[model samples]
Structures are given as structure tokens and as C-alpha cells.
Target: MRDALVKYGFIAVTVVLFVFFAATEPAFAQSSTMFSMLKFASVTAILGLGVTFTMVVGGLDLSIGATAGLAVQLAAMTMVFYNLTGPTAVAAVLLGGVLVGLANAVLIVVFKIPDLLATLGMMFVIQGAKLIPVSGQSVSSGMVLRDGSVAPGRFTPDFLLIDRGFVGPVPLPVVIMLVLVVVSWFVLSRTSAGRILYAIGANPEAARLAGVRVGLYRGLAYVISGLFASVGGLILVSRIGQGDVNAGASSLLEAVAVALVGTSVLGLARPNAWGTLLGALLVAIVLTGLTMKGFQYYHQDTAKGFVLIVALLFSFTLSRRKVRYTPAT
Candidate 1:
């Protein structure tokens, strides 16, 4: 009974919270409002998946947000500045993602720098470097460039459809998010590669002794993290249709928070894609509810922080209890 509660407590809390919000804010219960909320949450969920992969391998990926920012910026620059085709722009940005992943892998696995510090430094640097291409301006249609010339190209319709187009009433990004979750879950839960990665996270020395290539797997995890972050960025830019400088910065906290929150989900005591999605949904619901209650943007972080703390405590306490009550081998 206790084990079940630890595993399923979030479901109950999520229901209770939904009920409370629905009761307090009628607007939140509307179908359109729900769609909007889900759409907003999808980006965070996507990024959280990437973060979860890194966390599953016992590493942090602080640069995912910046990586995403760079992806969108480069894509926008290709389309609007260089007058490239949509596919070409997308290809360029995806390549950028791979490169960013390689950089993170080199720093962490090759140079042996701490994950937190390496990604953190990359975050600041990439976030700043992104400005150089746009001449420190946001990329929007008809926006004057640094040279006082108007941007000739706009977001192509095909690129815009990546996020905005629907397939049988489902938002594209939501569908993509679901697909990624399935893929991530499949890879992590089913594949030998995924098992080894998890093993390394749990016990690196043991994994190494068992012939696992720890360095290679560690680097691979970071590469995936970087790639997914870029995918998230691509989705966000496709939806918004502009390269807003601070958009990526805002996502960093939400992505990490939701990813960490996933760790305690279902008493799994590890990072998982479903938990990350659930965490993102929980945050989205709370924020939507708060917004209906007239919560200001500046103060919304407090509520988010509180939710994160409660989740951490819940997971930590249950984890300890699980160990205490476990039977000896």
C-alpha cells in the first residue's frame, strides 16, 4: 500500500489540483483554454525529455536552453536574412544542434570538466553568441537589421506548419512531443544501449568493470541532450515565427525544473520521459490557474518554485522509505 502510494501520489495530487483550479477558475476548464495550455507545455516537455536523458546518465545539461536558442536563431537567420529555403534553414539548424552536442560531449567527457560548470559556461556563451548573427536584434518580418536594411524574407509557410499545423485536431508540436516520448521511453526502457546508460548513471565503476564504455555513453547522452534541445527550439520558433533573443532564456528554468520534477514521479527515483511530461503538465496547469487568478508574471516563479520543492521533498522522502522497507537479497 505504501509503495503504491509513493508511486501514484502525483496522480492524486494532479487530480486534486485540477479540481481546485476548475472550481476556482471556470476559464481554465474550457476546451480552448486546455488546448492553449497543452500547446504551451509541449515545448517544455520536449526540452525536459532531453534533460531527462542527461540526468538518467547522471549528468546535468545546463546548455540545452541556449542550444535551443541558437537553433532557432540560426534557422531564422537562414530563412529571413540569407533567403534560404525552409528545408535548408532547418537542415542548418539541426546541424548546429549536432555541433553543440559534440561540444558539450568534448567538454564533459574529453576534458573531464564538471557537467554543471561546462554546460553553464556554454549556456552564457551561446546565449551571447546568438546575438552576433542578428546584430543584437530579434528576428522578425520587416524588422530593420543592424545595417538599417529591412529583412527581405519571412518565415516560410512550410516551416510555420511545423508547429502551427494540425493533424486531425492535434497540434503538431504536441504530436511531436508524444512521438519523442515514445522514442525516448523505448530507447531508455527497452534497448541494451539504454540499459547500459542507466547502469552507468547508477554505478559507473560497476558498469565500467562490466565492459561498458563509460566515456562514450556519457558523451552520447550529452549529444542527445543537445540535439533535443535544438528540436525544442525549432518547435518554439516555428510557433512564434520569430527569433526572440530572450525566449530561450525563459525556457531554461522551466525545462530543468520539469526534468528534475520527473525524478520523483511515480516513485521511480530516476529521470523518465513520462514523468517529465507530467511535470510539465503540472506546471502548465498551475500557471494557467494562477493566470486566471490574476497572478503576475514576476510572481509566477514563486508558485513554480514551491511546486518544485514539494515534488523534491515528496520524491526524496519516499525514496528513503522505499530503501528502509526493502527486503534483503
Candidate 2:
């Protein structure tokens, strides 16, 4: 009972804070504000889910933020330069993300490059590559077709709803986020591949002895991470109606923070979908609360650092208790 409480303490704290804020602030509990929060959560949750994959394989993909940014650039450029439809542009961007993921996998698994160094290098590569098409200019939404003519912006009301439009009472982005959460949960918890990943993270040598293909699984993990980033990038473009070169920079740190928070929740001890969801929600709630209070924006960064520190402390404390209670060898 005490152990369970320790594991879920953060959730309780978040709930309490949310209720308190909703009661105290007039605008905080508005339906529009709630929808906005969910929209923000969707972007961060997608990024966190991707980070979870790399962490499960005992690696980190620092390039996810950059990859997502590059994906947005690719999607926009496709529509602008190649005259591709939205669906086609999205498909091509996702495939590009997968190829980048595969490249990262090769660098780490085949070339013996460290995951951190390899991903960091890939981060720069993607960042620089994203600039090649626009030559450092933000690709205007009003782009010309390949036949040497300006293409007027297509303003389909139904298409706009995918990001900004809502279904009855729920926002479309929120629904998409929920669907992704379920799919990611199934992939990580119910699949044989998922178990293999946990095994690798816990002990790669032991997993190899058990006949698991460590290298292949590690590579696949990166690819999954990149794919998730692509989804996030698409949703982001939809929400803003345009993509920014700097959109992905903040996501890298936010994703890592959310993943680490998941590690501390419910004694999950491994990367988990529900835990990641809760973690992202917690961060969103904190930022919302702080912003509502008119706190300086810079203090939000301090708050994030504090949250991470506390979460790590809680994780270490719980881990020590488990070790101490285990039967003697």
C-alpha cells in the first residue's frame, strides 16, 4: 500500500494542483482553455512517446526535435515545391523520417558509435539539411507550383478542422493524440517486440543470450522514435498553419523531461505509455498554472528543472527501498 502511494504520489499532486487552480482562476477552467491545454499536451505527448522508445532500448535520440522540425520543412516544401497533396506530403515526410531513423540505427548499431554522439551529429545534419531547400528562409505558406506560377493557398474548412477544428465537443488534435496513446500503449505493452525491448534495456547481454536480436531491435527502436516525431511534426503544422525552423528545439528537452518523469511514476522503472501521458500532463499543468499566475516565462524553465530533480530523487528513493527489501542472494 505504501509502495503504491509512493509510486503514484505525483499524480495525486497534479490532481490537487489542477483542482486548486480551476477553483481559484476564473479563466483557467474555461472550455477553450481546457481545449488549448489538450492541444499542447498532444504535441508534447507525441514527442515524449518517441523519446520513450529510445530510452527503452537504453539509448536516447537527441535528434527527435530536429527530425520533427525537418519533417515539418519537408511536408511544407512538398506541397509548395512538388505540388503534392496534404496526404501525399505527409506520407513522404514520414518515409523520410524513417530513413533518417534507419541511418541513426546504422550509425549506432553497425558503426559502434555511441548513441548520444550519433544522435547529436544527426541533429545537426537534419537541422542543416532542413535549410537546403529554403536557403534559410521560412517557406511561405503561399508557394508557387513547379510550372512557374504562384499557387494560391487552399483553405478547405474541413481540412483545417484536423488541427484547429473540433468534433462536437472534442478537438481533433486531442482525438488524434488519444488514438496515438492507445496504439503506442498496445505496441509497448502487448507486443512481443515490446518485451524484447524491455529485456534489452534491463540487460542487453542477457537478452542476447536469450536469442534476442539486440542490434536489430535497437535499430528498430530508433526508427519508431523517428516515425513518432514525424506524426508530431504533422500535427504541429496543422495547428499553426505553418512550420517554423525553430519549432523543434524546445521539444527535445521537454520530451526528455517527460520520459524521465515517466520513469518515476508508479514504479514503472521502464518507459511506459500511460506514465508518459501522465508525465506530459503534469508538465502541461505546471506550465499552465505558472502562466496563469503571471509568473515570468523564464521561471518556467526553473520549474521544469525543479520538477525533474524531485522526480529523480523520488525514483532513486523508491529504487533503494526495493533493493533493500529484496531477499538476500
Candidate 3:
């Protein structure tokens, strides 16, 4: 019973939170509120999914938030400055993200920089670089450019449809996030590629000796992470109809928090798309419910931090107990 509780505790907590919020705030039970939670959770889930790819390979993607920010600026700038259409803008930004991933790969794989340090350094570089293109200004329609003239282009309605338009009463972001989660889960759990990644994560040296291309697999993890982050950025900009330079910091912190908490989800004890999505939903529910209750935004991070710590402790304790209980060989 204790083991079961430890293993499934996060799910129980999420259910309790939902029930408590519904009971305390009658409106929280409404379909509108549920949809709102799903919409917001979609972005965090996307980011967490990106981070999960890296984590599965015993790596980290600290630059996800900055990568998202860079993507937003690039996507927005392409449409507004280059007179590019929706698809062109998206393609440009996604390629930019892929480049960022390649850069991280070169730094970590080639130079042998530690994962955390490599990504952390990249986070700062990308964050600063994003601001330079816009002259430290936010990207909005008809905004004044560095040359002192108002920009003419606007975010096309077609592009906006990616996040705003609904398909059969479902939010677009929610739909996209869900579909990507299922696809990613299948790739990670049901394919030979997944087996190789797990083997590399388990022991990179052994995997390489066993004929696995460690550098290629490891670098691809960052590439996947970058692409996912770019998608999140696209959704973010589309939802707001503008690109805000300062958007990346909060996203980075929250997404990382959610991903770390996912490590212990359902006793997986490792990164998984399903776990990341659930963790994101939990974070979103807590924040949304609290905000509806009139809680200040500043205090919400504290609650989120507490929840993460509890999840970590829950997983750590169980792993230790299991190790201690194993009989002598």
C-alpha cells in the first residue's frame, strides 16, 4: 500500500487539487475554466516535452526558454520585416531553433563542455541575442523600427489560427500538444531508436563500444528539444499576436520545474512524455486555480516550488527504500 501510494502519489495529488479547487470555486468546474487550463497547460507541456528528450539521454536543456524566445522573435520578425507569409515565418524560426541545437551539440559534444554549463551559457547568449535584433524592443504590429519608421507588416490571421482557431470545440494548442505527446511517446517507447537512446542514457561509453553512435544520438536529443521549444514559441506568439522579448525567463523556470517533477511521475523514475504532460497539467491547475481564487502572481512560484520538492522527495525516498530492501545475492 505504501509503495503504491508513493508510486501514484502525484496523480492522487492532482485529483485532489482539482476537486479542492472545484469545491472552493464553483466556477472552476465549468467547461470554460477547464478549457482555459488546457490551453495554458499546452505551452508548458510542449516545453517540458522538449526537455524530456534531453533528460532521457542523461542530458539537460537549460536553453529551452531562451530558445523559445529566440524562435518567437525570429518568427515574428520574418512575417513583419521580410513580408513573409505564415508558413515561411514558421519554417524560418524552426530552422533557427535547429541551428541553436546544433550549436549546443558542437559545444557539448565537440568541446566536451558539461551539459548544464553548455546549455546555461547558451541560455544567456540566446537571451541577449534575441534582444539585439529588435533593438531591445518588443515585436508588435506597426511598431517603430530602429530606423525610426513604423513597421508595416502584421501577424497574419492564418498564422494566428495555429493557436487561436479551434477544431471541433478544442483549443488548437491543446490539440497540437496532445498529438505531439502521443507521437513522441510512440517514438520513445515502441521503436528501436528508443531502445538505443535508453541504452546511451544508461551508459554512453558502453553504448558507443556496442556500436551505437553516441554523438549522433546525443546531438539529436538537443535538436528535438530545440524543435519542440520553437513550437511552444510559435504558439505563444500566435496566442498573443505579438512577440515579447521578456517572455522567455518565466517559461524557462516553469518548464524546467515541471519537467523535473515529471521525473518521478507514476514511478517512472525517468523522463517520459506522458509524465511531462501530467506534470505540466498539475502545475497549470495549481496556478490557474489559485489565480481564480485571487492569489497574487508573485506567490504562485512558491507553491510550485513546494510541489516540486515534494515530488522529488517522494521519488527519492522510494528508490532508497527499494535499494535497502533488496536481498543479498
lDDT of 3 at 155: 96
Q: Give per-residue CA lDDT, model 3, range 63-178, as digits (tens).
A: 99999988889888988876679999899888988999999888888888888899999999999988888988888889888899888788999999988989888999999999
Candidate 3 lDDT score at position 172: 90
Number of the candidate with higher lDDT, 1 or 3? 1
What is candidate 2's lDDT per residue for 1-329, written digit by digit as tens? Answer: 65776677767777887898898887888988888888888888888888888888888889999988987777767765555677777788799889889999999999989888999999999999898767676555575544557755442344345678777788888888788888878987899998888778777888999999999999998999999888888887666665577768788999888888887777666678887788888787788888999999999899888877766666666554421111101
- Give the TM-score (vs. native) of candidate 3: 0.95
Model 1: per-residue Cα lDDT over 13-65, one tens digit each = 77889999999888889988888888889989999998888887788888998
What is the C-alpha RMSD, rounded to one decimal, of candidate 3? 3.8
Two-way lDDT contest, 2 vs 3, winner = 3
Q: Which scores greater on lDDT, model 1 or model 2?
A: 1
Whichever of 1 and 3 has more TM-score, that candidate is: 3
lDDT leaderboard ranking? 1, 3, 2
| Predicted structure with the largest lDDT when compared to the true one | 1
Residue 226 lDDT (model 3): 90
Best by TM-score: 3
Report the Cα lDDT for residue 287, model 2: 85
Score every model by TM-score: 0.94, 0.91, 0.95
Residue range with the least summed lDDT across 10 consecutive positions in model 2: 320-329
